[model samples]
Structures are given as C-alpha cells and as structure tokens.
Target: MIKKLKLIDSKFNIENKVGMLTFCRNDIRNALTGSCIINDIINTVEYINKNNTVSVLIITGEGKVFSSGGNIKEMLKKNTSFSGPVEEVEKKYRYGIQQIPLYMEKIEIPTIAAINGPAVGAGFDLACMCDFRIMSNNAFLAESFIDLGIIPGDGGAFFLQRLIGYQKAAELTLTGRKVSASEALELGLILKKVDPNQLLQEAKKFANEIAKKPKNTIRYTKRLLKMGAKLPLKEFLDFCALLQGISHNHKEHKSALKNIKRKM
Candidate 1:
C-alpha cells in the first residue's frame, strides 16, 4: 500500500487510479519560483511513478490563475532561487525549477494539464511537459520569458517545439505573446477547450477513461509511446516485443481474453 503524499504548496489526491495535483499558491498566482511548488511537483511525480495504483495524473491550479511562472517579486529583489551571481543562478536553474521537466519526462503514467487560467513563462512550459492539455475557454498561455529578457531556462523550448512544431513555437517564444484558448486549440497546443467551470470535470473525465484500462498495460503503452519518439524503428519494435511477451503472460491479459471469449 502507498502512503499519502505530503506536499507543502500543493494538494494531491488519488481517486479511481487517477491522481490530481493542484497548485495551492494562489497569492502569487501559483508562481513556480519563490515557493515550494517546485518540490511539491517533483515529489508528486516521483510518488506517482512508484504508485502502481495510479495510471493517470491531472495537474492544475487551485485558483483562477494556473501559474504565473517565476515570481516577479523574487526576480526584482534578486532573492530566493533568482539570487546570487550569474554562475550561481545557473546552478539554481539546474537544481531548481528545471527539475520539473526532467522528472516529468520520466513519469510512466499519462499526465494531463487542466489549464483553468493563464499559464505564463515556466508555467506554460509546465503544461507542455504533460502528455495532454485541456484548457478553459477563458484561460491563456504565454512564453513570456523573452519579455523578461530571459530565455526558457527550464526546458520550455524543448517541450513547446515538440508540441506545436519549431516554427510556431519560435514565433510564440520570440514574440512572448499570450495565446488564447481558441488560438491554442487552432494551433493544436490544447487537446480540448471548455468553459472554466467544466475544466476540472472534463480533465477528470478524460483521466478516468485512461485510468480504467489495465494498469500495467497503460504504463507499458505510455513507455512505448515515449520511446517511439526517440528510438529507431527496429529498436522500438524490439522493446515492444519484449513488453508484449511479458504482457501476454500477465493475469490481466488472461482475464481480458476470458471476457472476450464470454462476449463472443
């Protein structure tokens, strides 16, 4: 049995094999920096990877704003994670908020970002790190690092381009423009768009759909999808065969087959 997760800046819960993580720092618009949100997110991701009972994760903010990215107050004050010399700041990036993308990449379960409000700078990148994104009609996204005279130091460039292609990603990143839900849907950046009140409900509905599948099969399929993006065709197929062999012998597979025979 898995113990409950303790998070300082977020709320985490699991229901029906679906995990939901909500950013609780609404005061600073759920800023990634200058708060415990980063650790909360990384810890949650790590926990989910070890928790076989969870097959899907849904991330969102508790309040109106999903996340405002880095804390502007901290940036201006040059304190917290944004403090110190140039090299020190680089180290902070390596050891700090950058961990979100790195950890998120390794998660075995499917992740969905329920964008209830604006997700700017690293917040937008955070959403991109998820496998799927569902946005509220009133919400928006922005690659606003450029406007702050900084670049996407948290792997935003890597994930965003993969989501919407390099050209469009470049345009958004360079311009530092806010993308409306409609425009984001048109660009295929978001999988679905709904009213604000329905955002979480929609995300849960989708997450539950994935969670109800054979647990190990869901994880293996997610792994295959992740590998397919980087691995060569031959190597990918080889890995697939290995997993398939194991899957065929699992009790879940036998039960499924029996059910199919009954239906027939």
Candidate 2:
C-alpha cells in the first residue's frame, strides 16, 4: 500500500527487497517543507515495520543535495526577525519534522542513508537517523542551526554527540561548521564515502550485506543500541544478558553453533 503523504512521491521501486525512498523535489535540492513529507517518512517507516516484505530501506536524495535541511524560506516568511522566527518554525518543526527521525531511531529494520550530495540542517539530522550512511565524495554535512540563530532541532544534539563524541559534536554544533565526507568518515560520523556516481551502488551493496544477516539478531542489536543512550550501564548489562539468552536459542544461533561443531 502506498502510504499517502503528499510531499513525498513514493515510487514503490525495488519493492520488498529494499525500498528506495528519495526526496522528490530536486529543483531546490530536495529541501523538506514542514508538511506531509515528514509525516510520510513516519508513515512509510511504520508501514515497512509492519510489512514482512521490506527487509531494508535505502534513503537517498533527488538531484544534488540530500536535503538542504528544513525549508528556510518558509520559516522566514513566518517571521522576519530573530527569536520570533525561531518560535514560529520551532513548533512546526517539533511537531511535523521530529517524528521522522524518532521513527527512524526506533525502527527495527536497518536503514541506509545514501548521501548523494550535501546535507545541511534538518537534512543532517535526517542522515544521522540512519543505521548506516554511505556518502558521495561531494557530500558534506552542515550544522546550520546555529547560523540561523537557533539551536539544532530534529535531533541534532542527540545524534551528533553520539556519532562523533561530545567535544567534537559540541564544536561542530557551536560553530555551525560544514564537515566534509572524508572528515565525517574519519570522525566516525559516517561509514564510508563513494564517488557521486557510485553512491547508490555502494549503499545497495551495504544494505544487501546487512539484509543477509539473521533478521531477528539485527533487530535485537539495533534495539540494544537504541537503548544505549537511555539505559544505565548496569541495567543495560542486565537487559543484554536476557536478550543474548533469547538470541542463543534462536535457530540461526543454533545453526551457527552446529556449523562451528562441524568445523571442529
């Protein structure tokens, strides 16, 4: 079922194997408007989670940029000056935009962000939502929230600090600097960078490899990581101990144990 969210034009391309969800408006570098697209992302992800068919999701951009962040012009038109504009957009952003990343954060299936080009602002937050990221060499990540005289929303502070480390994430967010693909990979902000022409191919290859892993194990691992930020270490250890026991009894674990015995 093509979940209806207007800003996104779903192709249903590559179907159950992997869903290639791209931003449809490339004219403005596929920037997200504060409307249906964000809701669409939430709807699409939830739909995928319920469907047994879609094993992985590959999210990419349209023409040049992944997303130029949230719609700046829309925000500007709402309020011409300082804190007023911030409050005007903030309510819409929090309600309409944040859910996309939140859904992504809790998603069971592995998500691959194919950074076809530069991603800034909320776009950067969107990229950070993915389980793995494969970027184009031309792709850059910008923390533009500060430049706009606003703090990073759409999960900027939450994900960046985790990705690169507190001090580094602080510097980037505080400075509103644009980090290159090479620098991002080096800092552990991203997994790898591919040439622009090869970006999608690399993402698919990575997704396919993940798709081959035992599904429940992957889901459990992702769940644990999601809990990482929220749980105390002792509690986390207890949770993992229980989860690992469940995993051990799973058939894939049993099969792997059998294979190991045969090798011995």
Choose the strongest candidate by TM-score. Answer: 1
Model 1 C-alpha lDDT per residue in residues 118-197, reported as the tens digit of each score = 99999999999999999999999999999999999999999999988999999999999989999999999999999999
As a whole number from 0 to 100, the lDDT of residue 238 in candidate 1 is: 97
Worst 10 residues of 2 by lDDT: 3-12
Model 2 C-alpha lDDT per residue in residues 6-107, reported as the tens digit of each score: 335433455436777887767666776633456567777777777645678898877888988777766667443122555675676666667777788767
Off by over 4 Å in 2: 1-7, 10-12, 79-90, 254-264
RMSD of 2: 3.3
The TM-score obtained by model 1 is 0.98
Q: What is the TM-score of each candidate against the true structure?
A: 0.98, 0.85
